[model samples]
Target: MTTIKLHNTRTRRKEVFEPIEADNVRMYVCGPTVYDRAHIGNARPVVVFDVLNRLLRHVYGEDHVTYVRNFTDVDDKINARAAESGRPISDITAETTQWFLDDMAALGARDPDQMPRATQYIPQMVTMIEKLIADGFAYARDGHVLFRVRAYKDYGKLSGRSVDDMIAGARVEVAPYKEDPMDFVLWKPSGEDQPGWESPWSWGRPGWHIECSAMAYELLGASFDIHGGGNDLMFPHHENEVAQSCCAHPEGDFARYWMHNEMLQVEGKKMSKSLGNFFTVRDLLDQGVPGEVVRFVFLSTHYGKPMDWTAKKASEAETTLRKWRTLSEGIEPAPSVPAQVVACLADDLNTAGAITELHRLASAGDGAGVLAGAQMMGLLTDALGEWARGVDLSVYEALLADTRDKAMETKDFSDVDRIKSALIEAGVEVRMSKAGVELLPAAGFDAGKLEGLL
Candidate 1:
């Protein structure tokens, strides 16, 4: 068995992973709000955690690991989108939830063992909030419940910030009902027009942070093996979850190991709608970029670094996949993954390093080795292979070969030039040798563009 080391954000060091129980390795990841389509940036954490999930399952028995990711169906963003579109909040969340599922499936991400919705776990949230209040970590006033931040001595340990420094640096909301400015809301009043559940305090909804804590505790118990999300959630969201969970269940240590992936960029700039660089995963798929290409580009960069998505990288990845697919065609993968590739992944999920080993295997013409190594990293799977198949180049090869033969005899290559140019324009790589012509689809290949070429 290979030893796995992960960078623990809480300890700020790479530590060897040891589950509480060898038979039941558990993990929880903060999921999306489900108010809209998932952007490319949003897909980063999904792919990152999915890889970690795969590693854990591989190390432990397949049925030993339990992975849970939540859906925040109740949020201000969902309410706002519903209000603006004049649609029911339920309708929007349902549609966007399925959209997220479909888009992630395209990227070859397997669903977690458990996916809990915030709305479905409202009773659990209410129960936990009551425990916090009874234990004097929270206070309810004006029909609102807020957690006392300073009450917990280790409040800033995870983020490594003092209370005064956080107040100065963060955008703290000053409300009349709070005992402290840094105190966060566990539950707040919901208006008549908004969605709400009946609670002891009032008809209201749970705050953004409380949902994860409650859902995680109910589904994964008070303590779990791992908790993960993007670094963007480390400050307020994850910090608040730690405070509430620890206060509610002092017997458990919450999540033992914490992991966070870095953010993503687009073409050397932060992805923003104002810069015209913001696009969803579906956007890339609709633009004819295969999901495998997107996943490959992402894996090319280490998750700890800021990944930059570029058209050139996508083009190169597509070309690389095309070559590997041809070489590994009709080949059965090895029973287990390559040791070199697993070593790279076990060392903090060094996907870039694993990909380098894959290149070496492909260069050595080891087709079975390439297939096994690629599958371990969630690449080159059958689900994502449809894009590479169904395009037989026999007809094009025959036509190009016939055209070149006629041109060689007639000493006029006008017809050959026309045929070659047409194939090139259709994004087909035309390889001509003494033996014959071989036409392969490259990046941006459009079968529709070849309609008139034949």
Candidate 2:
């Protein structure tokens, strides 16, 4: 048995992970608000935590681990998108939810054991808010139920900021109805055109933060083993969730451990629509980037650091995966992942380090070991193997070989060089030897470019 260590944001230190219940280890990750397609940044936590989820299941029996990632179908962003498109809120949410599932599937992320939608858990959200109000941690004013931030002493403990400093730094909504500026909304009234449910306070919807606390409590109990999301959620979002959950149910700790993966950048700049680098997971997949390649590139960086996505990295990942696939072709995976690889993953998900070990295994020609280790990290699976197959390079190989043969006799390699350059430009690895020429698709190989080369 291996010990798993994770950096807990709540404690602000890396500690050994000990679940509350060894028989059932539960994890809850803040899922996407389904307003539109999930961007590449959104996919980072999905892949990052998916690796952790796999590790947890492997360490514990598969049946013992329960992963829950929620869908925030109720949000201002979803409402605005619906208003802009003149579509019903339900229609927009449903379509976008499916789109999210499809996009994540393309990235090779497995669906969580329980994916509770915010809409589906409306009753639970209402019940939690009612309990908060009854417990004097929340109050209703002008049809809005707001959590009393001061009521919870450890309000700023997660993000490590005092309430006064947060009030000064944050752009809080100055509503005349609220008692304190730091107090966040538990429930807000919905317009007639907007989505809402009848609650004790009014016909309203749950605030962005309350949805997670309620849903997680409902599905994963009052406290779970691990709670995770991007570090960007560490501030008001996660902070508010902690305050409400702890106040609403003081008997149990909210989440035993907290994990936050760092943000993502593209080409050394933050990925944004204004920066012209903002693209969805679908955008990359549609542009001919395989989902496995995307997953590989993501795992190349540590989750705690800002990962930069570059065309060059994607190209290299594709090439490397192709090589590994070839090396492990027709070889059955070993019964278990290499101990070295498991140790790396257990140390706060050191995927980059694990990949280095995989490279060493490949170099050692240990195909069975490489396959087992890569699969442990959610790579080299049969499902993601389609991208590497179904392409015939024998024709190009013969053509390059014939050109090399002629170049040997004529002593003018210009024509051969031209053909080789063309193939290389199309992302084909050109190998010319005394025996013959071998052509294999490298990163970003375009089969269409090979049409006229032969």
Candidate 3:
């Protein structure tokens, strides 16, 4: 059996991964808020955890693992969007949820075993809040329920910040509801127009942090093998979950291991709308950037490192994938993935290392090995291969060859240059050699642009 190691953010070190139960390995990751399209930054954690999910399935039998990523269908952001658009909250969440699924599928991610919506788990959340109130970890006042931050002695252990430090450095909500400054809401009162559920405290909705704790408890139990999300979620969101869950269920250790992938950047700068670099996964896909190329660029950097998205990397990734697809065309994968690829992944999910070994396999001319290895990393899958067939360039290649042949005889390269320029304009790379002319699709390739080029 291949041993897997992962960097446990809670422990602050890389540790060997051992499931709580060999028969039922469980993991929970924080999912999107579903108010709008998922930005490119939001897609990083999805792909990173998807790779981890695949690795676990490989090492353990596929049936033995239970992965749960929740959908935050009820959030203030959703309410805001509903109010602004004059659309019902349910309609907005449903549409955006499907959008998230489609965009992720385009990037070759497998849906998790369980995708629990927060709204579906409201009864469970209310029950958990009741238990917390009974246990003296929470209290209700002014039609609101708030968790006592000081009740949990190890409140900041996961984030390694003291409560005082958090109050100073973090954005602590200052509400005059008879509570300490650091106390967070377990449930808050909702207005008549806002989305709310009937609760003992008031007609309200669950707080942001309580949503994950309750849903995780109901689906994955109190003690799960792993919990993962972006590092940006480490401070308040995850920290609050740790506090609330442990206090509510002291018998369980919550999540045994914590994993957090680093934030993403674009062109070596923070991605922002002000910079005009912010874009969503759908935006890139619509612009002719193959989802596989996006996944490749992501795996090119380790998950723990700050990933920089650039046009140059995308172009190089496309070229490499095209070459590998050509090499492994019509070849069945090996019975198992390459050992080196698994080993690289086991070492704290060293995806970049796994990719390097794949390069070696491609260089060795082992087409089957490359195919199996790429498939394991959620690349080169049958579902994501449609982009590889953008437009069959066979006819175009033949036309270019015939035009060049005529130009050689007529001592006039005008027609040859015209075809080459049109192909380049259409984002196709025309390679003319003494042997032959090979046309390949490049980045931003649009098949519609080649309508009149013939």
Candidate 4:
């Protein structure tokens, strides 16, 4: 059992985790703002975090981990889209949420243990907003509500920006209702046609930051073991979330460990749909990249490093990854996953390091060991995202062809079972990968046909 140390964005240090409640990991990931189909930028966090989730399950018992990722179904974008499309807000949210799910599924992201919707938690948001106002952390004006930035002493700690610097650096809308330019919206009034909810602060919907704060509280509780998202959210979004949650419950720690993955750039620039450089998860899926390939590309780099997407680059990576599966031809049970691979994953999820180690293991002529090492990382699954794409299955397919004939023509009942047993001993999955007694010696297997008594 390897001890893991994760960089906690809150305290600015990598701390060895001691689960507050012991064995149970209360982890929360900032989920998608469901106003449209999620693009590649969105999928990076999904796969990266899913890897984190996977590593944790492999580290701690899966049943002991409580992973909660929320759906921001109610948002300004959802409202704006509804107005322009003449669709009901609920319809827009539902449609966009489904698109998000479909896109994430395509990228091979596992569904979180809990997916709390903002629309469904309006009451929770209201309760948090009301408490903030009562506690002098938030105020109301002109059918709107604004969170008082001055009230939270350490508001900009997460992003390393001082309060004054943050106000200057941020590109937030300068709404007239705000008491100060730095004061972010807690709730804003909506028109009759727009999405609205009856709240203490006029008839309006919850603001962006408050919704997450409320959702995390409702699902994971006041403080949890870890909270994660993309680096782009460090400021106002996560910064404000820290403010609201801490101010609401002054004595409690909102989230102990904060892990944020870096952004995915496209062609050396930030992935922006407006710039036409953004590709949706579906777009890449259609390009013959397996979901695992996408996950592999993401994990191949340190989660904190900027990853740029290019068709040529993705293709090259697909080839590089496929070379790892070189010798399942003679295998038995799924290769016993290597300990070093598991250790790399446990260490703040240094996926790139783990992959390097995987390649090292593969370059070893020990085919059995290589199979075991790769299988442990869960890279073999097609559900692993686009990483599985463009894999050259030629060699493996040849092995499969040989196995089929072997499983077919055996007239001796005793011989049939014994041959299948040998295939399993070779780490060749009989039903899944290569089945039957069909023997095509790998590039160099003793292809001699042996006549033996069954």
Candidate 5:
């Protein structure tokens, strides 16, 4: 029973969140275009929204939240990559999408309720494009379907940007067929080798922005609870979504709240491949940074604030998480869950505020009380998939037994002492494990450096 407020990008106001249905909350996030690996700069929104997803489920029942993130598999960028690498589009897309999943999983992001792909939903895109054309919101010219920007009166509402301003900063080429310089594509004709579907205008693929609008409408309906992405996507990307969805539906308003997290920078500069700062999530993971550490580093700052991806920050985040994890280990599961975190997360996903409240709980509360506080704060046990208590209890139980067995089986007091010392050094305190010996990842110790001690 806590109140949550989120900043709505469309309204330019922070509004209290009320689910469309009592407990069922639908959230749609724009996902990756699978041309290559998901870079470290690309992970801020992934972690930020994941925290929101965790808080929402804790607030409502876990089953009540339906999260949908889409995959842009048929994009021109992916096609171009395929041609350059001499790989098929499917191969490139599949490889990149799997890499995205693997790296994100390492960051402890919960798998979305549904991860829809554009290619799989081609019929939905085609049907939507046809409706736009029929409804006078879209037109086909030279085997391509384009959205008429001027037709939508409130086109600039989301970004708070005027069409004239967009024209001034326009880096995109104005094609001859476009009705206006600001006009964008709904569908474009495909070449012989690229992926294409049969459509009324031509054999082609859906455009970038249209895929989300189409997929969101098809899966989550016209109005969803929250729509989210990186701030870089605000302008032409999300603005077009608002126009497309509103023009297509014209009945219910699209997502009730629009949440955009700021961009990621490397050492205070924009992260780009040409600048040589471009780094994938795997790039960090391979360097021995814990995914939990990565998640903490992302949540440590305000979502609206641009964060720097640095090794030092990641280490600092790990130390921060270690303290919380140590506090969590002191207490047992409680019958009653804590309520403070719900309100903190509800307030525009203020995870930093939630962490402060957790500090209050750990510093002053008793065992049961501290555990209750941790529950409300939503720290995954063993950093398991966002908010869920990680690792089955049987694992804990078995480890306990193992610790005891180790004590009995080995009469080498020196070895027992060595194991204990090593465990403590690695961050865990060794007692009689459930299976005879139990080993917990030392929350405070240099678990990574423990290998040398052992």
Candidate 6:
């Protein structure tokens, strides 16, 4: 049995992972607010946790692990996007949610066991809020329900910030109706146009933080094995969830281990739309960058480190994947993944290390081993093999060979050079030797451009 170790953000240590029940390993990750397309930054956690989920299913029985990632369909951002687009909120959320699922599926991410939409869990949320108020951890005021942050002694334990420090450094919402400045909203009143539900306080919607807490509780229970998200959510979002959940249920430990992947960057700078570098997963996919290539570039860097998305990396990833695909063509995976690759994944998900091991396997010319290893890391699978399907170069090869023969006899290399240049421009890697001409597709290869180029 391989022992997995993960960096627990709550305790600030890398600890050995142990499920509350060996039969049922559970995890919850904060998912997207389905308002628009998912950016590259948003896709990081999906891939990172997908790998973790795969590893868990591999270790525990496939049916033993329960992974839950929520869809926050009832957010203010969704409301805003609906207002801007003049579309109904339900229509916008449904379209964007399917788009998200399609984009992630293209990236080789397996859907979680349970994807609970916030709207589906609203009754459960209302029930939890009622319990919090009864337990004196929350109160209703001015048609709004706010959590009493001070009620939980260890309010800032997860983030390691005192309430006073948070109030000083953070933007504490200064509402005249609130009792304490640091008090956060559990539920807020919604207008007629906005999405809302009937509650004891008012017709309103759940807050951003409470959505996760409530969904996690209903699906995963009061305590689960792991909770994960981007480090950006560490401060107020996760901190407030801890306060509300702990105060609501004191007996159960909320999440045994916490994991947070670092933020992503583009070419060493922050990715922003105004900077002309921000793009979604669908944008890259539509531009002919294979989804496997995107996944490779993402796994090259450790999840805990800041992953930089660069064109050079993408090109290199495409080339390497093409080579591996050719070598492992028609080869089936081994009975089990290699021990070295499994160990690398177990050691805090050292994916970069696992990739290094894969390079060694490729160098050793062990095609089956390499195929199995890559599949274990969710790469080079048959599902993502469409990008590697070779374009027919036989006709072009014969034409180039025939042209070279004529050039040798007539000393007229003009035609040969013209064809060679055209192939290069079309992203075909041309290899001309005494034997014949061999053409391979390189990165940025556009087979459509070779329509008229005999």
What lDDT score belongs to each candidate, Candidate 1 first?
0.93, 0.92, 0.94, 0.75, 0.77, 0.91
Please list the residue runs of candidate 2 whose C-alpha ends up more than 4 Å from where it truly belongs after superposition.
none
**Candidate 5: minimum summed lDDT over ten consecutive residues — where?**
385-394
Instruction: Show model 5 residue runs off by greater than 4 Å.
Output: 365-380, 383-454
Q: Can you list the residue pairs that collide in candidate 3?
A: none
Model 4 C-alpha lDDT versus the unseen true structure: 0.75
User: How does residue 114 of candidate 6 score in lDDT?
Assistant: 96
Runs of candidate 3 exceeding 4 Å displacement: 395-425, 430-437, 447-454
TM-score of every prediction relative to native? 0.96, 0.97, 0.94, 0.81, 0.83, 0.94
* Cα lDDT tens digits for candidate 2, 238-270: 999999998888987999999999999999999
Candidate 5's residue-wise lDDT over 16-97, tens digit each? 8888985779999999999998988778888888888877887787999999988889888988898898988899989999
Q: Which candidate has the highest lDDT of all?
A: 3
Worst 10 residues of 6 by lDDT: 319-328
Looking at model 3, which ten-residue stretch has the lowest summed lDDT?
Answer: 383-392
Candidate 1 achieves a global lDDT of: 0.93
TM-score of model number 3? 0.94
Expressed as tens digits, the lDDT of each residue in 270-350 for candidate 3 is: 999999999999999998899999999999999999999999999999988887887888889988999999999999999
Q: Residues 1-454, candidate 4, lDDT per residue (tens digit)?
A: 5677788888778778778876888899999888787888888888888877877777777898898999988777887888898888788788888888877776567789999998889998899989999999999999888899988998888888898777677676687788888998889898877788898768888889998899888888888888899998988799899999999988779988888988888888877768889788877777656665676677778887898877666655565555554344345524456778777877787888888887786677555655665555556543552332343334544554554556567644554456555544432333434342222222111112222311
lDDT of 1 at 118: 93
Off by over 4 Å in 1: 402-415, 434-436, 452-454
Tell me the lDDT of candidate 3: 0.94
Q: What is the lDDT of residue 91 in candidate 1?
A: 97
How would the candidate models be sorted by lDDT, starting from the highest? 3, 1, 2, 6, 5, 4
Q: Which residue pairs in candidate 2 collide?
A: none
